[model samples]
Target: MTDHALVLFSGGQDSATCLAWALDRFPHVETLGFDYGQRHRVELEVRAAFRERLARENPAWAARLGPDHLLTLDALREVSDTALTRETEITMQANGLPSTFVPGRNLLFVTFAAALAYRRGLRHLVAGMCETDYSGYPDCRDDTLKALQVAINLGMDRRFVLHTPLMWRDKKATWALAARLGGAALVEAIRVETHSCYLGDRTTLHAWGFGCGTCPACELRQRGWEAWAADPGKDETHD
Candidate 1:
């Protein structure tokens, strides 16, 4: 019964992978991005450049996915600073949470995404919210998502299926998923183009991807890439 899908894209490796997944499953796909004023605002630019690259190189896919939709919510400014929203040095929580864990981020994102999907007649909303590979964002948990989805659907009086392609994937597995979706070319794009750095530092490079490699996000990504490369099956998903 589902046809149209809206991807809550953030121009990161995970969201990019989700976008590819949505493209694979849906005949009609569109992207939704957020500009909620994170310090890594460069990701917005990265998303734009990615679309431009797609438009230039893969016009067919570009036409299929349509233009990237961005929502600029300044309410994050009202939210207190942690690290991602400020110029302060990034710190990690005792439970692996980093200052980058913008509270209610995924919750608000999915809720807004659901509302947008309802308005656009989209029955499926796809996002890359991985509890398997993350820095302790409580809202990324599957239970939270399920609850939020039901609440949003009830609030909107519409049935929207939220798809999380990377919920169980680690970084290495994530790379493998990307490779499967579009082969090495997609993997290469993620490595060279996507921005996942908390500090918004894309100048520095690493084996996994670009970022302040010392940050928690980078550390997890680096380890995941190593595990994936060392994987015997290589394409095997996490256990």
Candidate 2:
């Protein structure tokens, strides 16, 4: 594996923290984002500013940060009719999955990211897909990612390692990761800049971040914040 890496940054709390992790480990780190016509497309709008802030505030990360690539996969919306792509209410489906779960979203994301990384000569691909604190998307599971990694390497004939820093950690621990990565500055950036609302609601801002505060994403973030606030040291033992 080379020292270069590509992070599948979604301008969300998890992905931003993963970006920090990438920057800390990889001397050359780039970012890749997909625009699948999500309801919360505002998340895409915040990426540049957050990257700018990180580069401006942290010289070390700035030195390692590379170009960011945003690819529009509008076809994903044409195929996926989830709440994340439409104005439907966020609810649990009869299949035991959340309505916001976009089928094959992360799968496609990693595949595309792998393609880009192959062209860029990046040997490592980092993402924030987590089964621990997520919308119960099967594609986010560690097993799925591991299997996909093998397929990607076989199909592309290149060894690309997939790194999921938040796979085992819950949302509270994700917050702790940000704090540990870049201290209060990274945490504040994630709290203020990242967007994770399934409703696309950015009109209101909460301590955890901006969202409808009632959607599953917002609720999970809120709960994580509350838990982390109560005991910030709880994640100190996490690997």
Candidate 3:
């Protein structure tokens, strides 16, 4: 695989950390995001603002980071009935995986990203998918991602490395990683700028990010921060 990589940026804490990971490793890096009829579309706005900030404040890194590309999957609107896209009050848990779990969302995202990577001659596709301290989403598992990597490569007839920097790291470790990657400023920005709230509520800011503070994602992040603030000695194993 070549050195250039494309990151699946969602402007969330994990993806932002993974972007920094790509910046630290590969010489050439870019970002790709999707608009798949998600109610949390505000993250896209944050994504654009993040790229703009990187270009303005950190020009040296931003130059190699390249442009942030956004694509739309309008079909998702018709098929998905999840709270993330539907006009229903978001539900934390249900009979099975939470109502937020859009079926095959990650699968579709990575496949499309792989195609884009092949077309652009990029060899690596980085994403921020975590199993620990994450919502019960099967697609976020490592095995699922690994299988998809092989399938995508064979389907595209190209060798594309899929990098998931946040697969094992919990939310606390993710914050520490952000501190290591972009230092204090980036950490602070991630806390305030990124929106991980399932309800898309930024009115009540939490220690980690803006959220409704009651949703599963927000609860997980808050717990991680509690642990992080206790003994956050720059430890990668903050969890």
Error of 3 at 28 (Å): 1.2
Candidate 2 pairs with clashing backbones: none
Candidate 1, residue 223: lDDT: 87
Cα TM-score per model: 0.92, 0.97, 0.93
Error of 1 at 226 (Å): 2.0
> Which residue segments of model 1 deviate by more than 4 Å?
54-60, 93-96, 232-234
The best candidate in terms of TM-score: 2
Shift in Å, residue 141, candidate 3: 0.7
Model 3 worst lDDT window (10 residues): 230-239
lDDT per residue as tens, model 3, 28-64:
8989999987887888889877766655656667778
lDDT against true structure, model 1: 0.80
Clashes of each: 0, 0, 1
Q: Best by lDDT, which number?
A: 2
TM-score of 3: 0.93
- Which pairs clash in model 1? none
Error at 100, model 3, angstroms: 0.5
Better of 2 and 3 by lDDT: 2
Candidate 2: which stretches are off by over 4 Å?
237-239
